[model samples]
Target: MNREPLSTKEKLLDVAEELFASRGVEATLVGDIVQGAGQRNPSALRYHFGSRDGVLQAILEKHLTRIEERRAKLLASWPAPGPRTPRDAIELAVVPLAELLSTEAGRRYLRILGQTMYELAPDQMKGVGKYPSLSATIDLMRGCIDTLPPRVVDERIQGTLLLISAMLAIRARDMSSRRRPPLPLSTFQRNLIAMATSTLTAPHDEP
Candidate 1:
């Protein structure tokens, strides 16, 4: 039986995803991607993607757009005036992403995203539309968010979002490797929703 070989673009994307997940964008050189994808010519990367940043953006867009589209569909079907409970808000953020874990590339994307959150400054991450789905999801939770002190609301929400990403990255890694999951996905998601809800709704003491 014969199998079709990968196109130059496809091979680059496949190798770049794994390399970016393991070594981060800045650390993983353009040449590294080319070499990993089995291309001897360095210009192949440039031919396919204009630059390193373009490649990174392509990778992010591939995953995030899917997530946002899924969120948009979910949001449209949800009750009017947006999510009513903290769990509803949390589900908006988590479920679309959780759906990605079933695929190897999706798992790699999660790891790369977790690393990007730490490796890049805020401006550097803006290429991913500043996470449109998550921003929309959080906006829908403004009711719960309003319960926190105004000063702490921004920080608390940002921190909780980071925690969710980190947790899901770990879960993605575990599932990709076929390791025993610490908890069922549903249980983990419920626990995460509980934690995010508590964090958002927790009262702040005077500083």
Candidate 2:
């Protein structure tokens, strides 16, 4: 009964990602995704994804794959400020991720990711981990996180993750924010990397 599942799955994910990216995922429904993909099968969504969450997972895998490739390249080039220091490794890892937030696609993906991470209150970390690409990034970040101050590392790690998610979400929330010129993608990411690196690595004042 199933027909061309791969093509259907890909089409569904493509339409859904675009729809979710352009329109908040909450605003778009599974019926809407099926419609956008021009599929007539009433059970198209269920047959393909089994659930909306499944579709989301596929979309995330597509995006994360490209991002992981970039991260690997960057990590491979670890310059003088080598990863021996967690700060250096974290920055090396974060710069590429942050830079994407400044992009149109990145912003859209972030909005959806942010919602999963916070708004919808889903522990997408699990879904994300299902794919090795996303897990690799998290693993790298965790490696850096492991090197931080024990008393505060947990808090800082959680905060940094949240900050990145929030920043990406905020970018989408204000796609047309015109009060001030938006920071260029590279610059914003550079600053974000530094800020996050400093927040975790800087010696805190011990009163």
Candidate 3:
């Protein structure tokens, strides 16, 4: 069956995602995206998305909405009181995000997310009211690690997010480039979840 052609707006988004992922977002120019999308009009990006930031937001919303839905389902399917261990909560957090690796567009979004995540403030990373599923996952993970002081828990949570994004971004890049991923996909995912679980559950040392 023939695939449907992408609309002009989708074309722009596709090009923008690639450019933003390969080049740092700040380094990718608006004109580059416009030209890459084969849009003759210089204003096409502006017409579809108000500005560079708007384009970035659209890209994030497009991918994250799907991720949020998947996470919500996982959370709902849990047996009663929720995740029983640090690893269980970590699996909830990592699995939905890792599923993105199954598709090319999803992989590109992962790369883009990795680029942008470090720049976000702590509150922004939590996504707070905007992403209830993500917030709930964070809360669930926090409960599993409640032995730590509040500040330490927050730091580990942030670290876990950063680690997920960075590692998945590298995996995405490998898949995109056709490089041999050191481990098979199943092994990679299991190990990634294990590493993240360790980060969250590691014992805290006194300052």
TM-score of each: 0.83, 0.71, 0.92
Q: Which residue pairs show backbone clashes in model 2?
A: none
Residue 44 lDDT in candidate 1 = 95
How far in Å is the alpha carbon of 3 misplaced in model 2? 22
lDDT of 1 by residue, 48-96 (tens): 9998877887998888878888998998897667338777887787788
- What ordering of candidates by lDDT runs from best to worst? 3, 1, 2
Q: What ranking of all candidate models by TM-score puts the best one first?
A: 3, 1, 2
Candidate 2, residue 41: lDDT: 86
Instruction: Compose the digit string of candidate 2's lDDT tens values, residues 80-198.
Output: 64346555555655666666656667766776777665543223443555445456555555566575555455455556666666766676557634334378656766676776666
Using TM-score, give the best candidate's number. Answer: 3
Model 1 regions lying over 4 Å from their true place: 1-5, 119-133, 147-151
lDDT (10s digit) by residue, model 3, range 93-112: 88998999999989999999
lDDT of 3: 0.88
In model 2, what is the error at residue 179, expressed in angstroms? 8.6
TM-score of 3: 0.92
Model 3, which residues run further than 4 Å from truth?
A: 1-5
